[model samples]
Target chain A: MSSKAAQKQAAPDSPQRVLTGRQFMLGDHACAEGALAAGLDFFAGYPITPSTEVAEHLASRLPAVGGRFVQMEDELGSIAAIIGASAAGARSFTATSGPGFSLMMENIGLAAMMELPCVIVNVQRASPSTGLPTMVGQSDILQARWGSHGDYGIVAYCPSSPQECFELTIDAFNTADRYRIPVFILMDEVVGHMAERVEIPEAKDIPHVPRKGPRTAPGTGQFLPYAADADLVPPIAHAGDGYKVHMTGLTHDERGYPSLTAETHDKLVHRLVDKVRLNAADIVDFEEQDVDDADCVIVAYGCTARSATAAVTQARAEGLRCGLLRPKTIWPFPEARVRRLLEIGKVKRFIVPEINLGQMRREIERLTQLPTLRLNHAGGAMPTPNAILEIIRS
Target chain B: MSTPQPNDFSVVHPIDHLMRADRLPHILCAGCGIGTVIHAYVRAIDESGTDPDQHVCVSGIGCSGRAAGYVNVDSYHSTHGRALPFALGIAVHNPSLTVTVISGDGDLMAIGGNHFIHAARRNVNLNVICINNFNYGMTGGQVGPTTPIGAKGTTAPQGSIEHPFNLPYLAKACGASFVARWTILHVRQFTDAILRSMDKDGFCFTEVLSPCPTSFGRRNKLGEGLDEVEMYRERCHIENGAENLQDLDIDIVDHEQPITVGNFVDIERTAFHA
Candidate 1:
């Protein structure tokens, strides 16, 4: 079948090849398949609630495929080891939940500063501190953005179903490679545990972006490990490759040598922030349904977005002009598109429903500044479609 | 015009090739034992016969942390006390590379204490060298994890009531395959211990007692850098293969007992990746 036909059929079959056949699997298991499909061979993680299966599955499957799975002493080591592996020229990743994510904050910052390409999955649980281990919450949205101290940018994708979990994970790896930053896949408890049928496309058909290293051999040209080449990002050279590169968390020049001057600090930090900020248009992605000609627009993501779909469908049938907007990528917040929606004046207001106490709602309100009502909950349970529909009617 | 002949000083130095020439005149204080340890480390690398290209050095934040930056190899200047975990990552990924972590006592035992014990317990195939100066020398001599009880520091102006860690004891108890302790004065012994541990297949640890003249030494009346080294020569004793690392704590307050120094533990264990 042609490429267009494969997409048009929306069936499990594709023309070129079928990577993995359709199967009934849990969201966590599908996540492992996505990693395997993306050439992931190194997994270092500490198991936590709603996310342990992802690690458990990879632990057994990775070795057969010539990959390595290491259950580190703790979350800190998990993040550290993967960063080390990534620096050593291997595609690596790790998965964790609430407390584990918190423990990974410092090293996550190190990953960002070193410009290492790696992926982290936050199967979020409710928290102020380990609130509900087995339940879902999207409270980590802001934490995912600014959790690490210092000025830098990160890319995050939120998936609502097991299928999206499989697809977005591959994209997460590609994006991490393209930008040389730590990419996050923020999955809550429900989506991580829920079982569904997922069709993985053929490996060749899936997109892959490998980390770019120096084209010039080490010592031939003046190679600056941190030097940006037009894209505001530098190519990474692995150790033992004779690059003889030195990586440090401190502010440094492109030569990867520590330069503690104020001028050098300004130049390095601005580039780190701009690499993501300027490329926001390319990184932002979302799904909009019946958005135009609607009086009320409901913005949701992850597990809550799935429920919002039903609520919006019922509202439309009841003769209410309501639509649903689900974000596929949440970190480089789809600001331009959402701002355009608010500008057109078709939608009167927006309702933001989340498992947590209105975390992303604040960002939506901040961006649009329109009449935004927050449908909030403290988490352990998903908000019912009826509860959301009642808000749309009011 | 012809290039001038290389200086005699550079030719005789054991670590001249290992040093990052551009980064010479390191940031170490004149009497600081860090440079001495670096000399000993490079000598060990040469003696062990490991290719310098195949070795990676990782260090945490402190005066000692600067050691990684000055080494002519793939090195990582990790965040405070995070050298061990980061080095473990590099070692486990590339088993062909010999990974070493060099950091200070405050860095390895205080902020990074959990990682220290856990890395040993797991018995990862990495060599760790800790420079114990008894206080946080880089941050104006604050009290730290290895600060002896009733010792004076900026943070412990009233005299620290906290007891310091017996690092060799800690490493042995935490399951290190090889453990040893030596002062800066015992350069040959320290270098030999590092060379010996290089062949070990599991976690290996060595603690070097170095002087911090500017911060730790001045306040404690240990004299200048040379005075501190002289004190070590007088107070230190060798007790190789001695059991019970627990009783080997440095007693600064009483000043009566000799400071024990030597290889304390050497036993084989299964490596983590193996």
Candidate 2:
């Protein structure tokens, strides 16, 4: 189907994937289908609430397709193995919720530092530690960006629906592979359990990113694993090929070994962080709903965005010039565009109805310096359309 | 799949022929039993003719964590307490990849204690060479799972009153398929323990009584790194697994009690990795 045909079928206000056939699938299940569509060949994960379905789905499906799925002993192992598998020339992913994401932070930093490309699906849940494994929360936004230690760039996408779960996961892999960094599918427990309609297009309909192939053989040619092309993202040669690339958490040179010199560390840190910051616009995927000519805008993401969209539609019926600025990509946040909306004085006030106690609200307010209201919760009970509409009306 | 037989291969050094044992990649501290223990493990691999490429060694944070980096293999250094989980990743990803975890005592006992216990409980086909250095040697010489009674360290400025973890008993309690313990001073014995642990088809935990001299020794007046080596020599008793901790006297050859150094448990269990 053409983009317009699909968009028209989906319409502005319609049941998600309106024209697509549906069967029962949890948010995490849709995410697994998304990974499969994205050519996911390796899955390493520890079973956690809400996110377990993704692991379960991949475990059964990946092996059938001749891919590898490993239920790692824990989330730390889950992300570590994913990095190793990715470096070994496989599209890899892992799924977890709450504390599991915390456990993955260190190695995820290593993935970011080493510029290894892979996807991490975090099915958000209430936490400080096992706080409500079955319940949902959006408290990990700030954590997702800064969770992994050190200064670097990362791409994180939040999908509000199972279909987005399916779609964004593929985009997550594509962006990660293309840029050679870790990408996150930040879904919360609410979206994780939500069974929705999703149509997975043909493999040909989807785009796949194979890593940059080697320029020369191991012995004859020079190929620094950390050496970047004109695009600024480095091409890696897998280990077995014997090019001898190195990876460490410490600051290192292009050869991938530990280099203590200040100049080497500076260049390593700069290039490591710059590529993502420089090309964030191309790497980012976000959605701009009906925000033009609006006096009020609801800026939300994940499941909250779904409700905010409904609230926007309901408020419009009451003759309120309100719109929803739902972000499909959360990190490297759609700052330029959101700021553009404020800079041109397009929207008066942005309202963020997230599950947290104003996590993303402060961000919106800070960037736009506009009055933004946070209709927040800890995510056990999802914010209803009426709750969001009340905030908009207020 | 090619079962390695030690002595069939040439006995060569890891980094170089005249390798300054100090220049080893793991960079073991002066008195660490793990460095010597790794020396034994490398010797076994070389003597046994195991292809280092096919052998993937995994390790967690802490003192013994650097073993994977030192050895010439498809090595992985995962986060603290997760060497087992990641090793399971490599093992299941390629069951033929002789996956092993060389983890530290504090790493396995305190933080990753759960993964260690569960991996033992599940019997995943991964070899775990747990170095029980008795305290948090890498971070600070704090009282750890293997820290004996009255052992003073950075954390327990006063002699510790907390009961120390007995590595053999813990692994046996956790249902580890093969469990053993030996200090670095007992090089041949420790290597013997590792070789036996490696043959297990399920989760194997070989807790080596490694010493940490820098943090653990100096503060406790156990002497410097090499000085701490004598502690391991004097305190350990070569038990044949015939007696229990309760039966063994904690007085002679003792750190509260001479460590029960032997293969305490080995049972045929199904592998979870497959």
Candidate 3:
């Protein structure tokens, strides 16, 4: 039997409802639902801990929604397949944890060079190499930014709750489509496995951005596959569309053929890096609280932000003027808004807490250049509220 | 060299529309057999009667991998040794489209061997065309997984002691729906095999023995690409339905053994998409 037919046999027909109203769900499941709600039609992934639930949920849900789910042989193939599927004009994604993410690095570079729009949900686990498969670690934050060799920009989102897992996953897809780049949903193991009450927004209320294909028809005028529009992003034409598009990882001109020259290489690489770098003003997003009147601020993200919030609330009651600056979009680092918080809010000291050896904390220090203290924690565990509160008091 | 006179060649090339004309003259050296393999492949694609628009060509990094860029179709030049997985993505997502993976033996069999065998085991319905040139041509003719035993390469100057892979046997063992081997010298049989694999329903693989004259030939005393083609003419034998895949290893130094080539396996199975 065909895969689609088998999928139909495995699933019962239900109403085509977009939102599964208020209910308690795991962060991983919310991520899967978020992908479904965002019109995900292809999911190619390898099963791994902390992130396996995402593949499991999608495997069960995708076929019911007329989408295809392929559990590839390895993470290398999983990421490669998603790139191919996305190149074929399907909104595609994949999920992996530490070891699997390492395997995907090479192809992730390919996706960036080819400018294929796809989402990668990396449910973070403790690792230098399989350090803690079932425990939380935010160490991949740096890896997500600079893991793949070479200079290119990527958008990574951190979700602190299951609700944000659902909400931000949809946003990640939209961001990927708009930028024609691989966008990352960097979820820690705690957020991935933790269950919480998630409010699924009305389908009509949630916004989704679709990929922009070539404005002119293929075979009309010359179709330059890498020809950037005014916004520095090019329209993607899918395979089997008669576009006859040719793409490569090697540096190419606007025509998308490999042209190994200094001029072409410079132009292509600069444009790729600048697309997100120049558009940082529009792409950077974060959430701030009590910062307008605060003198001390705590910067955090992902699961650590949850602890940071409790610590901040307790510190505020203890007569400390502390607030929270939670970055929703980690890359494109949100420097302007962060600088504004320091200047406008007259913040003196900054406390950054993360579930790693100070990965994102360095970015905060570099961007703000303020007196920052890092509440660093090793992998396999998270910092406690009182632990962060102790730092806030200091 | 003087250009061919206007009347010396046909005014209108029949398969010109199927190639990226501006990118020619290609990077392959004059004696390389890769160009001929591509020629046979385009002919097979033409004869297969599938809409050209419905076909996507994918390749990994190598001299043979450049086939994807030259083809006048939606082609992706993927990372080294990852063509099968990339093609799998295209094929599995759009079952209506035919995704063909054309890459070199080293790129597919060495670094990418895991993806190749697993793809066959899953029956992904990809047209995997492996061009075996005995060494890594683009990277200066180093010994590869398919380099014949006792053959000389830059890395194996004294002579390679490693036992090379029997590609068809590997594919067959991995449960490929169809497996075949041929040389660029046998254009008719090679084209027919390519056409048959393209028309097949599951994981189909074809190994084409081509010449990398600059890399493999110069070191092994095989002369130029054309000289290797002549050697293939004298040494190659069609052994269809040969049961002993283990004995199919190529020993270039051992002239007593004939290089066996033909379709060794073909059967129907449930494809991943179908």
Q: lDDT of each model, Cα atoms only?
A: 0.86, 0.74, 0.87
Residue B197 of candidate 3: its Cα lDDT? 80
> How do the candidates rank by DockQ, highest first?
3, 1, 2
lDDT of 2 by residue, A1-394 (tens): 1232233222221222122345467889889988877777678888888799998988777665556777766776678778877755668899988788898898888788767788999998876677877887898898998887778888889999888999899899999988888999899988989998787665556777777866877654376667888888888765345454445565667765556798997888788788888887887667766688888888889988888888988999998999887778888888888777887796778888887788888778788766777788876777999998998888
> Which prediction has the highest lDDT against the true structure?
3
- Judged by TM-score, which candidate is best? 3
What's model 2's overall lDDT?
0.74
- The superposed Cα distance between candidate 1 and the true structure at residue A328, in angstroms, equals 1.1
The segments of candidate 3 whose C-alpha lies over 4 angstroms from its true place after superposition are: A1-17, B1-12
Provide DockQ values for all models, in the order shown. 0.34, 0.14, 0.66
Q: Candidate 3 lDDT, tens digit per residue, B1-274?
A: 5677854644435886777877877899888988888788787778888888888999999999999889888999999989998898888778778888999998899999999989999988898989999999999989999988889888988889998898988999999998888999888997998888888889999899998889899998989888988889899899987888778888788777799999888888888762
Which ten residues in a row are the worst by lDDT in model 3 chain B?
B4-13
Tell me how far candidate 3 lies from the true structure as C-alpha RMSD in angstroms: 2.5
**Structural similarity to truth (TM-score) of each candidate:** 0.93, 0.83, 0.96
lDDT of 1 by residue, B144-253 (tens): 99998888999999878987899999999999999999999999999998887777778999999999999988898888989988878888999999897889999766
* lDDT per residue as tens, model 1, A150-218: 988899999999999999999999999999999999999999999999988766777888788887787
| Order of quality (lDDT) | 3, 1, 2
